[model samples]
Target: MPLYKTITPNSQTTVKIWKITESFDVLMEEVDLKPKSLERVLGMKSELHQRGFLSVRCLLKAFGYDDVDLHYDENGKPYLKDGKHISITHSFNFSAVIISDSKIGIDIEKQRSKISIIANKFIDYEFSYLDENALNYINKLTIIWCIKESLYKLFATPGLSFKQHCLVIPMSDNEQETVAWIDYEAQKSRYNIHFLEFEGFTCAYAIN
Candidate 1:
């Protein structure tokens, strides 16, 4: 079993990510998943999905909880029956989860070259002032994607466009926190977004 590294942003919240080099079978064995969760895990063809579940389960266990007791809401958002707040995300070979005593969201993505091809689809004026340097641009794009993705997960709105609803504030690379706002019908609100880089990957989280 791979040891999970956890970052404590404060007393009420925790962020964790698992580097997915572990064999899928090993990770599956380490988690105490429920019958339905096991069935869903078996059904996932993408390593991303498996790693996400594995990481989420491990995070829950670290806090002395079990994934078996949790379920997803109508929008496919995972929720603990006891009302504990949680969010999960996965990309390529990495998976992450954020849990807090308050509402929370989290996302992770493997830094990739392909993001440039689809930049217009999700970015907008909110990022207009970002540094134009090549390295900085790539980093900002990844961070924006992660930030929007986190907001989308938190809102659980299926058709919300990242360019339209999720906004990332322009900031220097030295900043660890950003703001994300979602104005979809019935879900209009703002969240405190945070970003971090590790091992060539980027992660973002939003807390309400």
Candidate 2:
């Protein structure tokens, strides 16, 4: 199928998504798997993980880069040999990637009812737009979870707390763009957060 979504944010950044499935083998062939990378690739079991891995390779191919030469740092962040900014994610049967002129992050999540169980743990403000009587909208919670995940990937700072630090200003429930920010020490930077839903999944992207 055509990519679930393709986004061009200005002339510098592009994003694409795919629904994970057994058919991903066609896409998997696009990657150049070295021995070391193969070990990491073999450790992934679910379709989501494979699709996420495929996305990294697909993204590099899109930009005329080689996947075998790419590597990850100690924090598990992917780095390009030519210094291209890349971020990736996968959840259930969906995966996404964000490549940009600057650092970027992307995350996809399967909408789940359980997200409500830990809402307070990640959401600092009770979304005023959410109806008090309706506390179980799977889409809304998925958006929140995707937003936080996108932020984490952007910052690449592990100990950061989503609830206390990262925040989103919702524009809608099923479709919305939120603003995400992080404050550390005396410095603070904010990013434009974008969201889209497809094939029972929520995809979020963050760009500075």
- Highest TM-score among the candidates is held by which one? 1
User: Candidates' lDDT values, in order?
Assistant: 0.80, 0.74
Model 1 ranges with Cα > 4 A deviation? 131-133, 185-188
RMSD of each: 2.1, 2.5
Total backbone clashes of candidate 2, pairs 3 or more residues apart or in separate chains: 1
Tell me the deviation in Å of residue 113 in model 1. 1.5
Q: What is the Cα-based TM-score of model 2?
A: 0.86
Number of clashes in every candidate structure?
0, 1
lDDT at residue 63 of model 2 (Cα atoms): 56
In the range 147-201, model 2's lDDT, one tens digit per residue, is 8888888898877888877777765654568787776556588999888877678
TM-score for each prediction? 0.89, 0.86
Worst 10 residues of 1 by lDDT: 126-135
